[model samples]
Target: MLIIFSIPWLVWRLLKTDYFAPLVVVQIVMGIVLGPGVLGHWFPAYYEFVFTPTVVHSLNGIAWWSVMLFVMIAGVELDLGKAWQHRRESGITAGLALGAPLLLGCGAAAVLLGFDGWMGPKAQTWQFVVGIGMACAVTALPILILLMEKLDILRQPLGQRILRYASLDDIAIWGVLALILMDWSRIGKQLAFLIAFVVLGLAFRRLMAWLDEADRWYVAPIWLALCGLGADWAGLHFMVGAFLAGAIMDGHWFNQEKLDLLRHHVLLVMMPVFFLSTGLRTNWAVGGTEVFAAAALLLVASVAGKLIGVRIAARVLHWAPGEASIIGWLLQTKALIMIIFANILLDKQVITSEAFTALLLMAVASTMLTVPMVEPQMRRSRALAGSAGQST
Candidate 1:
C-alpha cells in the first residue's frame, strides 16, 4: 500500500503531472505500470514476491469496498430533479452525447469481433458490442466534478449545464450495465430484487426522512451493504446494487460540504487500491501491439463520437460559438467510471482482459486530454463573450 501510494505521489509532485493528468490520472498510470503486464512481466520474481496470492486477496477486498463506497457517492450526488427541470435541453444533450458514442463504439466492437482474444467466453455478440459501447459512453461524474473544480468552473452556469447532461447519461450507463449483466436463469431473482428494492426503497426513504442528519450517515452504509448483498445474490452484481443504494436516496438528506469531503477522502485514501487492483487484472498475453491498436481504435471512437454528438447538440440548441468543443471535451472525461464499468464487464466474463486493458488505456488517455483541451476552449469562449459584450 505504501509503495502504491508513494510512487504516484512522488511522481505527481516531482514532475508536476497535474497540469495535464492530475494525481488520480498519474496514480492510474502508475497502477498500469506496476501491474503484471509491465512490472510483473519484467520482474516476475519481484512481482510474485510482493503481490503474493494472500496479499492480492487482501487488496481485492479493500478495492471492492472502496469502489462500492465511491460508486454510492456518485449515485447520491446525482441531481436528477434539476435535470428534469430543464428536460428538453438536458434530454437532447444527454441523448445525443450518449447515443453517438454508443453507436460508434458498437461499430468498433464489431471490428474487434473479427479479432482473437477480445471477446469473453460467455459474452454473446450483442452483449460484447453493447457492453463495449456503453463503456465508451460513460462519463466519470466524480472525476468530471474533480476536473471542473480544478478548472475553477464547478459552480459556474456552464459547469452546471454540463453536470445536468452527465448526470442523465450516468443513469443510462448504469441501466445499460444492468441489462448486459442480466442472467435469464436468475431472472426471477432479479425481478424479486427489484420489487423488494422498490418496496424497501420507500421505507428507506421514509426512515431517512425521519432520522437525524448525523444519524443518516451510519444508516447509509448499512443500506449500501444490504443492497450490495441482495444484488449479488440476484446475479446483477454488487456494484449495481451499490449504485442503486445511492440513487434511491436524496442528496439533500446530507450536508453538501460533508458529502464532498467524503468523496474527496475516498478518492484520496481508498481508490488507489482499486486502481492497483484493476491494473493487476490487465493481461497482455494477446500481444502488446494488438492491445495498443485496439486501444487506439476505441480512443478514436470515444473521442470523435463525443465531439460529434455534442456538436450536434450545439447546432440544435443554437449554442454560442466554441461551446460544443468545450462541452464535448469536458464530457469525454472517462477515467474512473469507465474503468469501473469495464471492471464489471471483465468480472462477468463479458470481455477479455485484453479488451479490459485496451479500455483502461483509452480511459486514461481520454481523461488526460480533457483538461488540456477544454481549458483553452473555455478561455476562447470567455473571450468571445467578452468581445460581444464590448460590442453591445
Candidate 2:
C-alpha cells in the first residue's frame, strides 16, 4: 500500500506530464510494473516476500470494496435528469458512440477467437464477443470528470454535453454486463432477487429520507453491503449490487459537495490498491509479442470506431466543425470504467488473462491519447471563433 501511494507521486513529480498522464494513469502504469509479470520476473524472492498469499488476499479485499464504493458513487452522480431533457441529442450521440465501437470491437473479438489464449473456459462465443465489444464502447465517466476538471472545462457547456453522452452510455454498459453475467441455472433466484430489490429499494429510499443527514451517511455503507450480498447471492456480481444501491437512491439526498469529496477521497485512499491488483492480474503466458499485438488491434478498433461514430452523429445533428473530433477523443478516454468492466468480465470467466491484459493496455493507451489529441483541436476551435468574432 505504501508502495502503491508513493510510486504515483514519484512518477508525477518526475514525469511532469499531468495533462497527458495524470496521477491515476501513473498509478496504473506502476501497477503493471509492480505486477507478477514484471517485478516477479526480475526479483522472484522479493516479489514473493512482498505479495505472499495472505498479503494478496488482503489487497484483493481492499480492491473489491474500493471499486464497489467508486462504482456506487458513479451511479449516484449520473445526471439522468439532464440527459432526459436532451433525450433526442443524447440518445442519438450515445447510441452511435456505443454501437459503432461495439461493432468494430466485435469484429476484433471474432478474429481473436481464432487464437488459443483469449477466451475464458466458461464463456460462450457470443458472451466473449459482446463483452469485448462493450468494453470498447465504455466511457470512464469518473475519469472523464477528473480530466475535464484539470482542463478547466468541468463547468463548461461542452463538458456538460460530453457528460450527458457518457452518462447514457454508462447505463448501457452495465446493463449489458448484467446480461453477459446471467447464469441460466440461477435464473429463478436472479429474478427473485430483482423483484425483491425493487420492493426493498422503495423501502430503503423512504427510510433514508426519514433519517437525519448524519444518520444517512452512517447507514449508507450498511445498505451498500446488504445490496452487494443480495446481488451476489443471486449470482450477479457484488459490483452490480453496489451500483443498484446508489442508483436507486436520490443523489440530492446527500450534500453534493460531500458526495464529491467522498469520491475524491476514495480515489486518493483506496483506488490505487485496485489498480495494483488489476495489474497483478496481467499475465503474459501467451507471450509478450502476442499480447502487445492484440492490444494494438484493440486500440485501433477503439479509437477509430469512436471517432467514426461521433462523426456520424455530428453530421446527423449538424454540429459545428471540430465539435465531433473533440467529443470523440474525449469519449474514447477509457481508464477506470473500462478497467472495472474488464475486471468483472475476467471474474465471470468471460475473458482469459491474455485478453484482459490486452484490454488493459488498450485502455491505458486510449486514455493517454485523450488530452493531447483534444487540446490542439480545442485551441484551433477557440481561435477560429475568436477570429470570426473580431471580423464581425
Once model 1 is optimally superposed onto the true structure by TM-score, how far is the C-alpha of residue 56 displaced, in angstroms? Answer: 0.5
lDDT by residue for model 1 (1-392), tens: 99889999999999998979999999899899999999999999999999999999999999999999999999999999999999999999999999999999999999999999999999999999999999988899999999999999999999999999999999999999999999999999999999999999999999999999999999999999999999999999999999999999899999999999999999999999999999999999999999999999999999999999999999999997888998999998999999999999999999999999999999999999999998887788788889989999
> What is the TM-score of each predicted model, taking all chains together?
0.99, 0.98
Instruction: Predict model 1's lDDT versus the native.
Output: 0.95
- The whole-model lDDT of each prediction reads 0.95, 0.93
Question: Residue by residue across 1-392, what tens digits does model 2's lDDT show?
Answer: 88999988898988796989989998998898899889988999999999999989999999999999999899888989999999999999999999999999999999999999999999999999999998988899999999888777889999999999999999999899989999999999999989999999999999999999889898888889999999999989999899888878788889989999999999999999999999999999999999999999999889999999999999999999999999999999999999999999999889999999999999999999999999888889989999999999
Candidate 2 pairs with clashing backbones? none
How far does residue 149 in candidate 1 sit from its true spot (Å)?
0.4
After superposing candidate 2 on the true structure, give the runs of residues whose Cα lies further than 4 Å from its correct spot: none
Best by TM-score: 1
Alpha-carbon shift of residue 271 in model 2 (angstroms) = 0.6
Predicted structure 2: clash tally: 0
Which candidate ranks first by lDDT, i.e. highest?
Answer: 1
